[model samples]
Target: MSAPEDRPLLRVVKGAPDDYQLAALTAVIAGLASVSPAEDKAARRSEWANPARRVRRPLQHGPGAWRASGFPG
Candidate 1:
């Protein structure tokens, strides 16, 4: 791999850095901010559209099975 490609996925530079480093950090921050809201909105909309999807009560007591549970027919 080339030097650039061989670099770690994440890098931390201590102390002061050049303008390029600041620009790169700013770009990364901006990119993250741009995508985060869309992702959150999509997640919220999906939750609202599909919901948790819980089973209704009496799932195990379908139809006339409730009559056998000791309650009045």
Candidate 2:
């Protein structure tokens, strides 16, 4: 195994002196790593285009409504 210093990302992390800088760099790296390829990404949508996919329930008397919504009885 090579020394951590020999690895580019590890070298950068090890060279970060401040705790805040290390934290910020880690967050940035994590965010970048989470990015999906363009073709695999879902199209931007403001709302569910299909009404069938939306949750629908008639407004009713109090506690029973909570039960239907999957809350503890």
TM-score top scorer: 2
Q: Tens-digit lDDT track for model 1 on 1-73?
A: 4798787665566778778987798899778877744443443455545645553344346776756666533
| Colliding pairs, model 1 | none
lDDT of 2 by residue, 1-73 (tens): 9997786763453453678877887899889899986676776776667766575655557767756666523
Which stretches of model 2 miss by more than 4 angstroms? 2-9, 13-16, 40-73
For each candidate, what TM-score against the reference? 0.31, 0.35
lDDT of each: 0.64, 0.69
- Model 1, 55: alpha-carbon shift in Å? 25
Clash number for each model: 0, 0
Q: Provide the RMSD of all predictions against the true structure, rounded to 1 decimal.
A: 12.2, 14.8
